[model samples]
Target: MSKIKDTSVNFENKKNLEETCAEIYAVNLISGQWILSICYYLKQGKLRFTELKNKIPNITERMLTLQLKKMEEDKLVSRTAYAEVPLRVEYELTPIGKGLLPILAQLEQWGKLHKSMSEGSAT
Candidate 1:
């Protein structure tokens, strides 16, 4: 067997890195309906709040506001505020958020496969 690192500092750093990654992943993107749906739409293109609301009709304004705020905090989404006559705002995925698309796609595919398998087994 290979020898392991004997330094406590090294071990603590490794643990901290893993914990940070886990925390980042567990920032609750999909916990709220509006957030996941918002990301789904943003993967296509940027959208205004009203457009997003139209896409997700069941989400409350308060919930959408809260989710967007959290996503912004997590750097998963960019919020652009314009200083126009009527003032317009739009939301889009940051590079970090865009990076999540492939993983999300794989998860979606797996979910479909799992559902099909479950139905087949039931039949």
Candidate 2:
């Protein structure tokens, strides 16, 4: 992901929109290609790093790490690291994150309907 400098105009606009719009602010919290997908899987149960990797085989390890870190910072996901011989770590959604499941389901429905309509119109 490209860095958005705090001093930049785009950053300013984003900040303003996020601050003023509740819906936009909510969207901003989970804005990324893999975030919602990760959340979908986590809704099932807590998963370790490799298990998540298996679930999303196409995503690079670096990208997964970055996205998980971002979610942790945003308080949408929680990471637990266990001190053991092999060193186990797991990721799961926070309660606030669990709250997004219904909204995500609605969004998925809307996306499918919109895509189908667009495709039908194009033919």
Candidate 3:
């Protein structure tokens, strides 16, 4: 049979392009203001809604709820509710979310190094 040249590039397949853009997709998913922080906290262990609110003092209740809901929807977090007199809800990172810890740790290290360098230069 004669050689058939690939026409994928010429056709510009949107689905194929998106499938290859995982880095961009990841960045977009974690771009929310408190997403990184939330992931950091959850890395320690599961936490209740109020506990998360108390840990991150500056975050408003509405914002926390919204962020948690978004994270849950994205399959990055697992939410569990306990049946009791008082409603109890907890959130923990999913396996995929746990996979991001090393990346986050690297970012943390970079931030610290950058801060130190900036301070040294300022002096």
Candidate 4:
């Protein structure tokens, strides 16, 4: 995702919208191509970086690291490091992140419904 400069009009408008609407603000936090997908994978259980990468083969390692870092900063995911040979780290959803699963499920259902509706209309 591209970062909008804070001084830009678009950025200002986004800040205003987020300030006025809690839902918009929440969506903004998770508004990346990979964030939702990452969360879905994490919903299963704690996973190592490589494991998460395996689940999302299309995303670059750099992008995954950035997303994980952002999620950690946003309190959506927790990271733990183990003092083992070659070093080890695991990522898991925080309670707040777990709370998003039901919401995501609803979104999935809505997407299916919309897709079918669109296809039916096209035919």
Candidate 5:
């Protein structure tokens, strides 16, 4: 068998690793403000476009459309269209999207605690 290696890292390596991780997390999760919320709602069940639009009251249909398109492109959501006299489309989280819920929950909890801390300090 080959000799084992020293896997420990130095200061520069640690800094680089941290920076890389932050960059990756931002790329994956920070692309759009509505993404996590959209995923959360879909986790409850599938929703039609109008239903989703109603759920997120602040978001315009145009903006929601764009965000959903991006999410679909990123493989985080799946859109299905039904063949009928009046076509109907529904959106739901893909397996990949469902995988993000726990992570989002943790981040959301962190954000809430951080916000409270900041407000307390400001007072």
Candidate 6:
């Protein structure tokens, strides 16, 4: 059996590396296969279940549901339900989720740069 590293550390004066690994935590939280895609779509605005499904054509309903549930649990997305003749539900990013947009954008820029460099070198 493998061992897990102790992550707890006193944070009274300064930040602890293990205890304050926000980047690691962020990466793990959004590391799901469909998470970034889902966040990209939701970043535009609120979307219903069907709308979200249509936006991500290849994702199965089950997978989308699961990802959404996990994101909701992580406080990244908000699920709202309305009572009406036809019940309605919408999902939108919470404040924390919105804060991730800049990071995602930076990642996208980095990916583009890497891809360009890779292709140029391969030539």
**lDDT of the candidates, in the order given:** 0.81, 0.94, 0.87, 0.96, 0.81, 0.87
TM-score of 5: 0.76
Which regions in candidate 3 have their CA more than 4 angstroms from the true location?
1-20
Error of 1 at 20 (Å): 6.7
Candidate 5: 10-residue stretch with minimal lDDT: 1-10
Tell me which of candidates 5 and 6 scores higher on TM-score: 6
Listed per model in order, the count of residue pairs whose N, CA or C atoms clash below 3 Å is 0, 0, 0, 0, 0, 0
Q: Which residue pairs overlap in candidate 1's backbone?
A: none
For model 1, residues 33-116, the per-residue Cα lDDT tens digits are 566678888899799988998898998888788888889998899999999978899999999989878977987899999999
Per-residue error for 90 in candidate 2, Å, reads: 0.6
Deviation from native of the Cα of residue 11 in model 3, angstroms: 22
Candidate with top TM-score is: 4
Best by lDDT: 4
- Candidate 2 regions exceeding 4 Å error are none
Instruction: Give the alpha carbon lDDT tens digit for every residue of 67-95 in model 3.
Output: 89989998899999999869999999999
lDDT tens digits, residue span 1-123, model 5? 122244645545755655879865445443556887798789897999999999999998888998898889888899999997688999999898888788788988999999999999999
Per-residue lDDT over 59-102 for candidate 4, one digit per residue giving the tens place of the 0 to 100 score: 99999999999999999999999999989999999999999999
Q: What global local distance difference test value does model 2 have? A: 0.94
The Cα RMSD in angstroms, rounded to one decimal, for candidate 4 relative to the true structure is: 0.9
**Candidate structures ordered by TM-score, highest first:** 4, 2, 6, 3, 1, 5
TM-score of every model versus the real structure:
0.77, 0.94, 0.81, 0.96, 0.76, 0.82
Ranking by lDDT: 4, 2, 6, 3, 5, 1
